[model samples]
Target: MFGRIGRTSVKHPWLTILAWVVAAFALVALAPALKSTTDQADFLPSHYESVQVGKVQERAFPEQDQPASIAVFWRDDNGPLTDGDKADVAKVTESLDKAGFNLVKKIETSPEAVSPNGKIALASVVASVKDPYDEKLLESVKELRKKAAPLLEGTSLKMGLTGSAADALDSQESSGDTDAMIMMATLVLIIVLLGVIFRSPLIALLPVLIIGVVFMVANGLIATAAEVFGLEADASVSAILIVVLFGVGTDYILFLLFRYREALREGQAPKQAMSDAVANVGETIASAAGAVIVAFLALLLSSLGMLRAMGPALAISVAVTLIAALTLVPAIFSLLGEKAFWPSKAWRKQPKHTLGKRIGDLTARRPGVVAGVSGGVLAVLAAGVLTFHPTFDAGSSLPDDLESVVAMEKLQSGFPAGQTDPTWVVLEKTSDGKLEQAEVEAFEKKLAASGFGEVSPGVIGAGGDVAQFAVLLKEKPSSDAAMELVSGKLRDAAHDAAPEGSRALVGGLTAVFADIQTAVNRDYSLVFPIAGLAIMVILGLLLRSVVAPWYLMLAVGLGFGAALGSTVWLFQGLQGKDGLLFTLPVIVYLFVVAIGTDYNILMVARLREEVRRGQNSADAVRHSITHSASTIGAAAIILAGTFGVLLLAKNSMLQQMGFAVAFGILLTAFVMALLLVPAVTKLIGPRAWWPGIKSDTARPAEPGPLLTEAPAGDRASV
Candidate 1:
């Protein structure tokens, strides 16, 4: 199948190129933009209690809504507020309230909103009915900041905004800049690395230009699919898509280009070399991509809508990249031929001393020693996994310098820590009529008296059958303590004490985070096994061996563990952070396990190819590693370097993901794929393909002595 694709692409290069151009352009022009939401409730099914509670609040309390943002004020002199400072804060609040800005529903300030110490005061700004991620809300936040800056100039007091609206505003501004930063970093990484390795400007820039089109095409198709299927993309998918395309896209291209170059040095014509390149490595690339696609599609099993949407979106991207690597990438290189490496001229001469040769010789000569050392490094790092702590504190993850985080800290100093984002307990008379006021008050008292903290008087909902009470805790909303209260003590108290014929539901940011934790834990159990099983199936099919896939996957798994454990050790143990972000494990699995699988597949496939030749298992291991080393090394560095750029992002989650994935890819290439996999293959021999192949006996080596030559007898076909 890949041979035919290569032949057709080579036969009609211009036509193939033209088709891609047209498809990419039309898709870019016609497809709708993808839409995403910031509300955690929006990403969950209605079955979860947090989601159900959100529905009740939306339906029952349409008049007085949750505040979109909160402004905390204090004296700049760092003392108790004087009458003058208090008057200035009141004046600024009144001014902003009367401005009547779009999306600004109302602003509320009262004596009760002031802190008991008289050092701080609070104002709540509510937005009109709209999506939490809506641009209008962000605009209103910006406008509010603009107007308040001048209003507070003459005062002794200062104000800082915190909560959802402020976060949305910050995320919106940063994501745009983040995209640009990632793109620039990715481009520079690719160009510099490719330039250094190939010593050709065309080689450095070709993949960039090619993958840029892939990005446009993938995004357009994904956007179109989202529209057709009503998929809810995560708000950050665009940024992620950027890295995935460049990282994986470059990987596939490297697979082909290296083979193409090696074939050229072996004296094959441009067309024949291109054909052989695609034919040889095509299955390996396809299998690697297939593994990733299946893993991503496994997210369909995730209870979280964010993963469901992201899973397919990313699968589409890999599918597009795979096709381009097989068809479009080959066509262009086929046409460029030997001229593609014009200035380098190195393709004509194989260097006598190469690192690939050295590593290959070491592995081939001392398989046991190499495997032992590589496996030991992973085992030591994997020890850190036992100490992993998942951080639920969103505020803590935000840069400490961010306004929302800063303002939140200021608010904690003056008010009940959780008051900035209170948990609302809703009671509904489940059987049908108006809720008895006595029952509602009793429920409120039960919540407050249970030791969680203050509870506001009940506010009747639109229907008399429902009532709402705001509960504030001593812990910050995003803290583990707050989530435990919401998920354990507070929820248990509410459910157990509800009046007859009524039910109590806990809602609010803390409850929502707790519910998110539940969903993620469920995914860890369900999604990981499913994805791992699916990838194993892909490998089994690609390798024609059930045995090879198991240990290959095992190696990849170890690599992922080491990557994750190292991240936890760095951020939590060494840095003394309260915890790493809760969602990082999932990110690491997707990038490290799924993506790192690519390196393993390439190495193992080449090992099998060498075995099919006349060489003994040990020689095959040496020969395969020698030949595949340059390709894997350069690709790993490029992909890892691009992800490493994520460390430059200000967001803690991005930084964690960047480090985990980058380090993981390098570990897979240099350690697992390079040393561990080949060494194990040498030990397992022909039986590793048990039930698939009949013989493991060595064939006599062929006549070729070229440094870059493939093993002698016609290599086995996929």
Candidate 2:
């Protein structure tokens, strides 16, 4: 099947190229732009208590004056606010409201807004929209800041905004041009690495040009899918998509190129070698991409809409890359023929006694020692997983020097840490009428006594059916402690202490984080196993052996643990961070489990090919490593380099993700695929193929040889 596709592509190279170009252009011009939402609630299902509370708020408090942001006012002299400063604060608030900023509803300040210690004054910046993270609202906050500087010119009061909207804006500004940085870094890394490896500028730059087109097509398709299906992507999707497409696309390109070069070295005609290249490596690439796609698709089981949306989106990208790899790559290379590696005559011959060959010989010579050492290293690193801690504080990922973060710190000096965002415990009538005063009082009292925090008096809506009580937690509202309080004791107290006629629901950012934590935990249990099982099935089908899939999966699983544990050790243990991003485990799992399998698949498939040629188990393992290791190493370095560019991002989440995925790729490529997998397979012997044996002694006829092992006439068809 693969041979047919390759032959057709090579025969009709121009037509194939034209088809891809036209399709990419059409999609780019016609597709709707992908939209993203920063609202945490949007990622949750409507069934979650936090989401339910949001719905109730919309119904019960339609005209609520919910502040989109808060302006913290302090004396420039760093002293208590005097009477003059408080009056100036009110004036500044009024002027900012009247500055004609879009989406600005009203900015209010009162005498009572002064802190008890007289050190600070507060102003609420309410928006016309409910979502504080709305882009327009963030724009309004930005404009308001500009307008305030002029208003406060003559007054002693200085003000800075700190709230959801302002924080989002600051985060956006702090990450300025980061996507450009990542793209540039990735391209430069790939170009440099490829140039160094192939010593051909054309070879280095061609994949970039090809993958660039593939990138646009993948993005257009993703956007069209999102538009048609009404999917909301998270803001981080664009950056992640860039890496995945380029990284994986380059990987597939290298796989084919290596085989093509090998066939050429055997002296086959250009087109024939290209065709044989596709036939030889096609199954391996397809199986590897299939494993990744299925693994990504497994995110459909995730409770969080973010992961659910991400799954299909990433799967679509890999699918496009796979198609391009099997078609466009071969078509273009077939036309270029030997010219693809122009200015470098090295492709005409093979290098001798290289590191890959040395390592391969070592592994085949002493499989047991190599397996024990590699496996032991992974196990020791896996121990760090026990210390893994998850944090939900999005603000912490932003630069501390940002205006919103600095303002938040200042606000905490005169108020509680949770003053910027308080948890809400609502009491509502189960039937229709307004909540009884006694019931509201009882719920508030119970909540305050629940050990979560101090609860404010109930604020009843105009409908009178619901009352909201703000809980100012002792910890920051986004802290792990706050989420724990909301998810555990606070929730139990609210549900259990509600009056007989009324019901209670806990809602707020902390509540949302708690719910997200629950959803992530659920996804870990559900999505990881499903993705792992699905990949194992792919491995089993590809190897035609159930026993081989089990050990391969175990190796990949161990690689994942090692990657995550190493990340946790660097961030939480060495760097003294409170915890990793709440979604770190998910990101690590997807990349490590899926991508890690790619290297393993390539190695095992090569091993199988050598075995089919009637080579002994040890020689097969040695030859597999010797021939496939350089390809794996080069691809791994490029992919890992692309991800490692994320370390350049100021956002800690991106940095952590970058390090984890990059390091994991290196570990999987070097330790697991190159050393451990080959060593273990060697130890397993012919039983590795168990029920589908194809050894020299077991098979009725000798299987086809690899291009390197085949006779000159047979090389064209191999």
lDDT tens string, model 2, 1-718?
Answer: 8888999999999999999999899999999999898787899999999999988888888787778889999998889988788888888888887777788888888888877788989999888887888888888888888878888898887789998899889878876777897799889988997788678899899999999889889999999999999988888788878888887888888888877887788889999999888887788889989999999999989989898889989999999999999999999999999999899887776665367678989999999999999999998887888999999887888888888988988888888777778888788889867787787887778777876666899988878989999887878888888898888888988999988778899998889999999998988999888888999898888878888999998998899999999998899889898889888888877777787688888888877767776778898887777777677777888888878877878888778988999999999999999999999999999889877664534333244534222111111110
Candidate 2 regions with alpha-carbon error over 4 angstroms: 449-451, 694-718
Q: Which residue pairs clash in candidate 1?
A: 614-699
Output the TM-score of candidate 1: 0.95
Per-residue lDDT tens digits for candidate 1, residues 1-718, read: 7777888999999999999999999998899988888777788878888888888887898666778899999988869988877788888999999998788888878877888888889999888855655788788888888889999987888899988788767755643477788789889989998888778899899999999999989999999999999998997799889888888898888877877777777889999888877777778788889998998999999999999999999999999999999999999988998778869776576654366668889888888899899999998887788898887775675667777777888888888888778898999888978998888878888877898878999998878988988988889888888988899989999999899999999988899999999999999999998899999998888778889988988888889889998888888788787888788888888788888788888877777666666667777787777777776777788778878887877677678888888988899889998899998887787878677544667764344321122211122110
Give the range of the ten consecutive residues with the poorest summed lDDT in model 2.
Answer: 709-718
lDDT of 1 at 105: 88
Model 1 per-residue lDDT at 449: 86
lDDT values of the candidates?
A: 0.83, 0.84
Alpha-carbon RMSD, each predicted model: 3.3, 2.9
Task: Supply candidate 2's per-residue lDDT for 271.
Answer: 98
